[model samples]
Target: MAVAAVGRGASCNAAARDLGCATSTVVSAVRRYREAGRGALRDRREGNGQRKVDERFRERLTRVLQRTPEDWGWCRPTWTRELLCLELERRGLPQVSVATMGRALTSLGARRKAARPIVQCPWPAWKRRRRLYELKCLHAHKPPEEPVLHVDEVDIHLNPKVGHDWCLPGQRRVVVTPGNNQKRFLAGALNVRTGKLTWVEGKSKASDLFIQLLWHLAGEYRRARRIHLVLDNAAVHTSQKTRKALAQLGGRIVLHFLPPYCPQGNRIERVWLDLHANVTRNHRCRTMDQLMVRVHAYLAARNAQRSASPCLRRADLRRTA
Candidate 1:
């Protein structure tokens, strides 16, 4: 309508007054209509007035992104989009907006991911021991009659696990967590050969709880002459009471300790990871009983799946006397 009024020789100011817009808006619209015809009068939805970031500028930005902000004499360890924009402008490139910088970075295949915590194993001997254990388990002439079980304990708190969930971009997800700090410790053993799991949940992770788990394992594998239990060097596992319990079991159970601070060596650690991902991550259980039910259900479902697999059956380790 503004363009039609201007085409009829109405002044830009008169058109603006009629259309309830600024004079500049009418003038610009008339110019667009004259230059590109009626197509320009219609809203261009493709570009949305955002300037396309240059390819050369993107390459330069990617190089900067590959390095920390400290490399550019900034006091920060990481780069924010605002910081990158400032750096780009400082380097005599086009003054890019933060949103444009983000788009450019994403186009360059860069992503925003949380940093994972890593602990470098101080003892290289642990790697060698782990490799040896794998070889013995995999390529032995005959399967070991005794089951090899990886044992570990995981503490589940009443507090909700803060994790990623489907939500609108730029919106934070709020998970309701109770003030009560009630916690349960699950002492679990994963059978390496049969892929079976046996676990006991307790209010506290103590030597007594550890001893009880050991007894439970003993009863679970009573037919086998000996069971090889791979575990970590937690204080409770090596305590005097635990040793006494092992002595009482005679030669029926043997404990193999992984190197200190080496959780990756315990296969049961992977089970805990799966458990958290399936039952606990982003979950808010109302009560301790509900949490226990969820945990038990997860374990039971896993055991059922394993039991169906013919390859994961219990090994016969008995020898003729």
Candidate 2:
């Protein structure tokens, strides 16, 4: 057995040391291998067992990966290994281990990811009432057909995300070789009421791109009676240059910012979730042009058919225990 292990690429000295009989015992193992064929070294249980994610699972894994978290009523897009293990267990394969669950996701070309940051900031009594009053007034004044748009930015990477495949949990990642020399960003907006999406490629999260995204909305929404923008308090959103650019729009679009640290109120939060689930999971772009192309394609396709994924809605937020 020791010689068989060594012949299969184990170090000879290590093999001899492990078997603990003698180097000559390894010679016996080798002779047995020569006489009895490869099966001489097979363990007693070798042919009697199978792994959990054997042939029966491949189809189920494919369908599971293709479905969004919202499709299953999960309140988040990203799936944890625990979630996967539970899925397998619920399907009557209770033997699936967490490690095996991870392997299955990797084999399906999905990356394990944490939930995105989503916090609803609290407002002081005064500001809270003032905003509620403003919302009430706007609600009363708005025509029945008016719509609200929520806008935000999300980042795409340079490298294919690393340490996400065939990797052990808790292993620290080494490096992220920048995929392309250039960096890119995305500016996105969504209709909160109608679940429509609008997105464009951006050079960076500059005040200019921010303003330009607003301009794009204005041009696209020229016929709407009023456009109320839901926003979070990013520095770019409040930049002087962006404000100047907004001023140039002649008040055609109204900005309704969530209180500080409160990004959950923006409907674009849901759009970004959908973006990753449908397009960005394990995405690879070797060049900046390729990155831009994929992003644009994703945006265009989603704009044509995107629904606000139920996972990110305010109603999906769990009540405090």
Candidate 3:
């Protein structure tokens, strides 16, 4: 307005009065308009200026961030923002603040993620055992008269399973959980041939529960001449009572124990993950009975869909077989 008024032959003092500003302000605006045109009239705050660490240094940091701390001769398995800044200094690079380092890492597709714990096998024969198990799984599809099955037990607590969920920014989601310490044990078997699930829910995963699951499996695949059951080496599975129960089956049920600490070799482990993701994770059932009902319903729905459901199909034992 000041510039337009001045352009129309109004005096600087008159233009300032019309725009509600001092004459010096009007003179400054006129000078800016003449020097840089109308864009200078817009309000713009001054920035903090260029980053301390330039693009070249950030490129180097990205490469270092791609690797583990141990890869750089550090004893630690992971990297922290503070440690990363220290590393930059040690490597003769420009030092950055922890906050700045975090931003740089994020721009390079890095994220602050929790490490997933894995069971390590210290046994020398672990490789051989794993290979043997893989071989069994590979050949499990053969022999149309018999089918292979992977069985395992998963424990679900009355406490709500906390998992990721979308929420408002800077807010956390709260899930209601039962105060009483109650748990339900689920013993389940996945059929490699048909992608069917045979399961039994109980209070405890004891030898008796395992035996009952085995009987259920026997009843499920009654037409098969032999059932090749693959399971983990849980204490209950190899107990004296379980041995007696196996004896009663009379060679109809052949049990194959996976290598110790190698849950990855058991295909049913994937099924349990699917169950938790679908029926339990981020879910809050008011009562244990309600939780059980939901679990059973989820299992039934998945079984009905069979290969059609994404979760069931993704974890399909038939693919492993």
Candidate 4:
């Protein structure tokens, strides 16, 4: 409303503040409006030239981004603007400059980011699908008297997990780590029906730690006839010692192993990820005790948050399930 604001005798600075834009922008807009009526308010670039990045180019770029630079016979593993232009040329598409390629990528909402590592299950597709279906059915149709939990373990360290953070233009955030890192391990179970979490920490990520978590789960869910845990095939979870602990617990706790190499199948994995993101990443806690304190505090806060809201708990249960 630069024209309206100027019509009311507001200064360019005042109009700019009202519009949340630069003063010069308001001045230019008012000048244009005065000179050329309302038509000048429309985009002036409409008839400048033929568009360089059209839907066809954007669609091609989208397909290219889904694959890697290596797929197009490039030695490099990652895509760069220059390499993208070259690949487009090789594919018999109209060649563009590096800058044009960047603009096109921006338009397509593509970004340069670190690749996440994933492990594919080695099982045959049918076998994997069958096992996943079984797990889904187990989660959906398990007896109400038996509680199902997604179980996983996480390592906590005196050394902070480094991650990105906001900082001044030329400044970087630093996290100090104890040179000789001390470690703590947490075994956690996330309830499938509710969003409740039960966790126990130990000095080592061993069979003892897994058993301790089992004991905690057994106690926490004492009312249930059996506690069904969906866990990965970690050595600690399948060890002789762990089996003995389970036997001693008298089948009160049953284990359901997920398809091999599929951490995504375990809902508790997301809890561990949130643990890292919220408490452990770039943490300034100097000692193992301090870090553990922070970790426990974060988990406790999370549990409390989950327990306080019924609607949120239901939504979380659905999302994780």
Candidate 5:
């Protein structure tokens, strides 16, 4: 507006007043426009001192982030802005200030986050990869008569699951606990194709909990010749009692165990996570029964939304004594 006002023969002081800026600002803009004909309006900092965080520097920073500080002979395990600056300088790059390094990391979409603990799979790399490939092929190319399900178990407690929640600044949200924690367990199976879920609850996450889920699946998928259950290798799953239950089923259900500690392969793990996030996390239910009711309601709604077929009948979700 200032530039246009000046172009329309208005004085610098009038243009500055109309644009709510100082007269000197209007004068400088007009001088640049006259000298370079609009190109001068572009950012003047383009050629400012050789770019500190150029493409090559960003690539090196990314590589450095992938490794630990120990790899660079630093005593610390994690990287800080000052440490990052020092590391970059050690790599023969131009020394940048801590603030500059912080801005560079922000530009690279880096964030300071708590590191998650994970267990490494004990199987050899080749064996693990081959098994995962086999499972993938089975899931993709399974016969129509055979149904594949990713199975897993989760625990529910009367004591609310503590997780991140939104609250006003300087205020924290509180979830009252039951004082005495009461727990229940759920074993669920997620359909690979239809995304339907079949689950059963029990007092404990024992072999019977898994067996109850197996029976529930058997009843639901009666038409399927073989119900292939992809599950983690939990001890209860491979227990003698579980084996006996499978034997009684007469090969109608087949258990395909995933490599140890590989929960990512089991799709049902995501369902349990959603269950916790939506129903169990920060819940205020005072009794296990109340909590279970809400859990059941959430699962039923989820199944209704995901399954084109009819939802599971109420009796099917009965808790095992």
Candidate 6:
């Protein structure tokens, strides 16, 4: 109340005159304000926040990730969320949260390793221009009635993708467990227009395997007059061997490459996400053959959807597919 009065330019004598209270109350409030600023208005019991990890702690964490976990007095060589926290605590840092450790590891480049060696950090400028030109050509023209298939491969992990469980606020949940064991490989193509899908189980994602899938698609969509293909700029996709094979198809198809780092523009990317969510997440397959069975079932289901809600009008599918 005194602070409120002070805000209104109420002098101590003026406050006393107006409220019939002692002037000492207003004087004390103004004096506290002059000494402490706005923070004086807040309750003293409120905590500020968690103490930050110091530079010493961050360096220690970097060192921990640099070596195998076993080297740091741990029995195992691998790093796990639980083990990271325990190690930090053992090293004299206050217990760090799993999420905090995860972020720190990422900053220090300790997350997933690159899938393959990158010969060049950045591609040549002309290479970039050519890719851009191809993308521009793709984006400017609407797909003809036939579908443009962007084929890709994803590993089908054996482990079930457990859904997030309910938890009280501020509590933690298990992120990973040893129980997951099933895994397989998935090769698929996405139709852009109606968002239809077609894919298969594959032995490998090698260049030959990819070409075989293309051949299968060509045979399947034979009655279709033309196919516009959108592919990534992968070494295998543009290799001389792959080109010679694609060229053998005559002028029946047009192959266009998407710009690097621009997978979001590919509708098939979303299809992969959907398949992972709906079909693969809960699946637990022991063998490649068993995983193939489930994959075929999922593919048939997707095909059924395509038949019911045809991705594009025969004309549109013919053109923009």
Error of 3 at 36 (Å): 3.3
Q: Can you give the lDDT of residue 28 in candidate 6? A: 74
Cα lDDT listed for each candidate: 0.80, 0.68, 0.81, 0.85, 0.88, 0.67
| Candidate 3 lDDT over residue span 1-321, tens digit each | 899999999999999988888999999999999999989898764565555677877788887878899999889988888989988889988778888888888777877788778877655686758766674754555586788888899998778678998899999988877778589999999877788889998898799899999888788778889988888889999999998988998878888877778787788888888878777777777778877777776677678777423443333433332
Q: Per-residue lDDT for 1-321 in model 1, tens only?
A: 989998899999999998899999998998998899988888776666655488778878888887889999999988889999998888888887888888888888898887768766577876857755763564243246777888999998778677777889889887788778689999999888778899998989999888889999999888888888888878999999988999999968887777777687787888888778776777777887777777777677678776321122112101100
Candidate of highest lDDT? 5
Candidate 4 to truth, TM: 0.80
Q: Sort by lDDT, best first.
A: 5, 4, 3, 1, 2, 6
Give per-residue lDDT, candidate 5, residue 239. Answer: 96
Assess the local accuracy of residue 253 in candidate 2 as a C-alpha lDDT between 0 and 100. Answer: 76
Q: Over the stretch 1-321, how does candidate 4's per-residue lDDT look in tens digits?
A: 887998999999999999899999998998898899999899888896778688988888888889998987889988889989988888778878888898898888887788889988999999988988899999999888998999998898788889999999999998887799888999889888978888998988889989999888878888989889999999988999999999999999999999899898898888888888877889887778766766676676688777322223334433333
TM-scores vs. true structure, each candidate = 0.65, 0.51, 0.71, 0.80, 0.80, 0.48
**Candidates 4 and 6, the one with greater TM-score:** 4
- Residue 305's lDDT within candidate 5 is 75
Runs in model 6 deviating more than 4 A are: 1-146, 161-183, 306-321
Q: Evaluate model 4: give its lDDT.
A: 0.85
Which whole-number lDDT from 0 to 100 does residue 6 have in model 3? 96
Q: Which residue pairs come into collision in candidate 2?
A: none
Per-residue lDDT for 1-321 in model 2, tens only? 676587888765677888776777677677878899777866666665776687678667667667765677778766667876666566777467787777777777777556556555577868866775665466456674566767888887666544344558777545545544566788878775556677766777888788888888888888876678777778898889988877888877788877777554455777777666544555555566755565565555555555422223222222210
Q: Count the backbone clashes (under 3 Å) in each candidate.
A: 1, 0, 0, 0, 0, 17
> Candidate 5's error at 269, in angstroms?
0.9
TM-score quality measure for candidate 1: 0.65
